[model samples]
Target chain A: MTAPSQSPIYDRVALIGLGLIASSMGHAMKKWGLARSVAGHARTAETRAAALELGFCDEVFETAAEAAKGADLVVLAVPVGNMGALAEEIAPVLKPGATVTDVGSVKQAVIEAVAPHIPNGVNFIPGHPLAGTEHSGPRSGFATLFANRWVLLIPGEAAPDAVAKLRAYWEAMGAFVEEMDAAHHDLVLAVTSHTPHLIAYTMVGVADHLRRVTESEVIKYSAAGFRDFTRIAASDPTMWRDVFLTNREATLDILGRFTEELFMLQRAIRMGDGDMLHDYFTRTRAIRRGIIEAGQDTAAPDFGRSVTGAGE
Target chain B: MTAPSQSPIYDRVALIGLGLIASSMGHAMKKWGLARSVAGHARTAETRAAALELGFCDEVFETAAEAAKGADLVVLAVPVGNMGALAEEIAPVLKPGATVTDVGSVKQAVIEAVAPHIPNGVNFIPGHPLAGTEHSGPRSGFATLFANRWVLLIPGEAAPDAVAKLRAYWEAMGAFVEEMDAAHHDLVLAVTSHTPHLIAYTMVGVADHLRRVTESEVIKYSAAGFRDFTRIAASDPTMWRDVFLTNREATLDILGRFTEELFMLQRAIRMGDGDMLHDYFTRTRAIRRGIIEAGQDTAAPDFGRSVTGAGE
Candidate 1:
C-alpha cells in the first residue's frame, strides 16, 4: 500500500557508498522525505565531505560499519568488485531485521558476493536501478535521477514485508519497481547494457589507436556517430571494470553474438551487397521505434539534442 | 571576403533531392537570404509536394534537369548510389559557369560517380555537413540544423572564387567550414561515422535476434547503454547502405581495427583482467572530453536528458 505523501518510508537509511546512485537516492529521499535520517559512508574522506556539503546526507561516517550501526536499511552502492568486502565489514554492525540491498549492475555476481556476509537476521535483497548518467562521483547526482526510471529488486529468501517495504521506499522516490530473478536479470542486462557498453568502449578504443586519423580530427568530426560511443565509453571506469569482470560469462556470450552479426554485416560490405545492408538497417529501425513507444526513450529526433546541443 | 549581411550569395540554387540535407539547406538559405530562389526536385511526388508545402523552395520540378535549369549553384543531395545517374540527368542543363556540389557522406566515391558527368566549364565541389538527426524525410528539417556544425568541403577543380562563395554561404548558415582531400575525408569518416554506424546496427540486430532476451526487454532496459545505439541505427537505410557500398575499402580497414581491438577486450574479460579493462576505458574517456572541449558535444551528463527526458 502507498504511504501518505511526504511521509518517511524508513526511520534511518545507510548508504555505504557516496557515488552517483547513492547520492541521487540521498537527494531524492531528502527531497521527498522518504527517510528520517540519511547516513553515508565513502572510502575516501573527500567524497564523505562532499556528500555532507551537498546536503544529501544528515551524517557522514568514515567506515561502513559506523554508517550501518543503527540504520533500518543499508544500501551497498559500491562497485561490484568491492561488494563482498564491504558486506563483510558491515555485517557485524547491521541491526537485526534490517534490510540490505545493492545498486550493482550485474545481479548474480553481486548476490553471490554480498549475500554470504549478510547476517542471518538481516534481510538481504539485491537490487539495481536501471538509470545513470555517463558522469559519476558524489556531486554528479540530482534528486530527479530516478524519476520515471526502473528499479529492479531480487528479493532472495527475504520476508515479504521487507521486500514490500523496500519496494514502497523506491516507489516513493519516483521509480517504477519490479521483481526479477538474479540469473535472468544478469542475462537481460548483458544483452541490453553490458554488451553495448563493451562494444562502445571497443569502438572508441579503435578510434584512439588510429594514427592516420589524428585525435584532433576524430574529436572535430565526432558529431557524425562516434560521438555517441564516446559518451558511453566515458562512464565510470571502475564501475565498468567491475561489471565486465563480474558478469564475464553473460557479457562474453552476448559479445560473441554481436561479433557474429558484425562479421555478417562486414561480409555484406565487402561483397558490395547493398540489398542485405539495406534490409538489415531497415529492420533495426523498427526497434528504435519500439523503444520510443515503450517510453524508455524520447521520440524527439537525436533525443532533441540538436540546435540546443549534441546528443547523448 | 564576407558578403553584406543577409545578401543573396547566389541568384539561383537548385537542390537535387528533397531529403533532410536539401530541405534544411532550403530553409536556411531562405531564412538568411543566402539564395534568391531555391528550386527543388525529388524522385517521389509526395516528397516534392511536401517540400513545396513546407515553403522551403520557390519552385518544385518533376525532374533534376528541370530543377537545375539555369541555376547558378546545384547541390546533388541524393544517396551515394544514385549520384551518377542524377548527375548524368542534370549534366546537359548545367549553366557554363555554374558550381555543382554534393552533400554525400563519402567524398571520393561521390567524386568518382559524378565527376564524369560534369560539363567542361562547370565546377564540381564535394561537400558534407557534419550535422543531422536520426529523423529523415522532407519535413524533418529546421532553419538552424547546421548551426555551429562542421561542413567539410573537397574542392577538387573548383575555381577559387566558386569555392569561396560556397564557403561563405555555408558560414552564413552558421556552420564552420573546413577544406580536405577526398581520400582523407573518406578515411576519416569511415572511422568517425561509417564504422560506428555498422557497429551500432550490428549491436541492435544482435539484441533483436536474441531469443532469451525478448525484444520488449531490450527496449525496456535500453537506457543503460543500448538506447544510443538504436538512435544511430535508426538512420535512413538507403543512405547508410550506399555509404557502406561506396566506402567499402575504408570501412573495411576501420572494421579490421575494430575487430582486433574487440578481440583483445574479449580476451581480457575471459581472463578477468580488470586492470586492462580499466586502462582501456580510462583512455577512451579523454576522447570524449576532447570532443566536448572542441564543442562537438555537450558536457552535460546524459546530455542532460535526466528527469526532463531520455538521452540521445
Candidate 2:
C-alpha cells in the first residue's frame, strides 16, 4: 500500500462501458481524490455526452481504446454480454503493467469474458460490487453508493499480488472487498439476489394481470404488500434481462426448487394449516436478523431524501 | 361530537373477545382516557388473565354476560366464526339502549353474526379497523397502533346516528374514519388486504418448500421482491384464516382474477418476450408511485428490517 502522503491508487483511471456502476465509480474516485483523473468511455455517443455533461467523469471518450490509453486502472462496467468486446477494445491500448478490473454483478461471466484479452504485461481481475440502486445510467451515479457495500473479487488462484492491489483500490473507494471463487459467487448470488428478483417479477406480473379490480385500486392498496415487488421489478429492464439471459442456468435451477416449495405451501393453505404458515414465517425471521447484523441494510433506506444524518 | 369535554361515549364499556385489535383499542382508550374503563371478557379465562397481566384492559371477566352487565357500549372483538355464539351469551345481560360495535376485518359477516341476538333497545353498528401488527395477544397492543390508520364503519343507512358516534370515537383514538357499504367494503378489502395477504402467504409457502436453493436464500436475499411477500405472509395466520373464512366470496372472486392475470405473465416469460416484461414492470412503477402519494408507505420500508419489525 502507498504511504498516507502518496495515497493515490491510479494516476489516470479509465472507466469502460459506463453505467450505474461505472459512473458511480468515477464519482466516488473523484470524491475521495483516489484517482488523478477520471476518464470514461461508452458505446453510445449520447451516453458519452451524458457522462461528461453529468460531470461524473473528467474525460469522456467514444472508444474504449482512447479511454484506456495511459490509464493505470480500467474498470469494465457494462452488461455481462458486452464485457468481451470491451476487453478486446481496451487490451491493446491499456498501459503495460496496468490493472484491469470489472464491477459486474456476476463474476463468472465477467472473468470468462475479460481474462482472454489481457495481454502479457497487463493483469485482469474480476470484481462484483453488491451495491446498486434500481435506477441505471450516468444520472444515477453517487459517490457514497458503494460505501460499506461488498465487492467480490475473483482473480482465479494465480495472481495474488494483483488481487491484493485491486482489493486495496476497492477499499480506498469505500467498499468492503472479499476474494471468492467465481462459481461459488454465482451460486450464492443466485440464491440471494437473482431468485429474489425473479420472485418479485413474478409477483408483480401476477398483480398486474388481476382483472375485475380497477388498476386504481391496486395502485392505491399496494402498501399491503405489492409495493415492495414493484420497487424490485422496476429495476433496469435491459440489465435484468441480460442477467436472466446470462445467468440462466443458476436462476432456472433456483426457480425450479422455489416452485416445488411453493406447491407445498399451497397445499398447506388449502388444507387450512395455520401451524405450517406460523413455523415458516417464524424461521425466516432469523435470516432477516442475520442480514441486518451483516450491515447489508440500514434501519430503513430513506430513498429520494438523502437522509443519512441518523447514521452520521 | 360532544364538544371535546363531554362524557365518555360509553359510561360502562364491555369489550367482548380479547385479541390484538381489542387489546390495542383497550390500550388506546386507557392511554387517552377515551373510555372510563375497558372491561373485557374472553371465552377462556387464560386470555382474560393475559389481557389483565399485560395491562391491556382495565378489568377482565370470565363470562360475556357478566362483562356486559350494566355496560352502555359493547365491542365484539372475536373471530368472525364465534361472533354469533358470543352475541348469544351477552344478549341477556346487555343494558337497554346500549350501542354495540365490532372490530372484525370483514363487515358483512360481523353484522350478520351479531345483529341477530341484539336486544330490543340496543343498536348494532358493524366496524372494520384497517390497522394491526402481525403479533397477536394482549402484549402486542399499543396506543399508537391505530394512529393514522383507517377505521371503516358500515351502518347500512338505518344506523347513521350510531355510525356517526363510532366515527367520533375512532377519530378520538387517532384513526381516520371512512364510511363504506358493507358489501363494497368487503370487496375493496379483499382486493386491497385479503388477496394480497393470500398471495404473500402462497409465495412464502412456495419459498419455504424450495429448500434446496431457496429455503435459506429466500430470506437472505429477500430484497429482490420475495421479502415483501414474506413480510405480508408473516402476519398472524389465525387472523388471516378468519379473514378468508369470513370474506370467502370476495376473496375467491379476487383470487380467480389474480390467478388468470398471473398466467398471462407466465406465458410472456415462457415466450421470452422482453417488451411485455418491460411494459408490465414499467407500469407497476406508476402504481407504486401512486401508493406512495396516497401516504400509504414511507419512501421505502426497511427491506430486511420489516420482517423483524413485524414481531416488534
Chain A only: TM-score per candidate: 0.92, 0.89
Candidate 2: give the clashing pairs: A261-B206, A261-B209, A261-B210, A262-B206
Where is model 2 more than 4 Å wrong at Cα?
A1-6, A43-54, A109-121, A267-312, B1-7, B17-19, B42-56, B79-84, B108-115, B119-121, B199-227, B245-271, B293-312
lDDT of 1 by residue, B63-89 (tens): 999999999999999999999999999
lDDT by residue for model 1 (A15-123), tens: 9999999999999888889899999999899999999899999999999999999999999999999999999999998999999999999998998888888888899
Best by TM-score: 1
- In angstroms, how far off is A148's CA in candidate 1? 1.4
Q: Evaluate all candidate structures by whole-model CA lDDT and list the values in order.
A: 0.85, 0.68
Candidate 1 chain A weakest lDDT stretch, 10 residues: A303-312
Top candidate on lDDT is: 1
Q: List the residue pairs that clash in candidate 1.
A: none
* DockQ list for all candidates: 0.57, 0.29
Candidate 2's error at B311, in angstroms? 12
Worst lDDT 10-window in candidate 2 chain A: A303-312
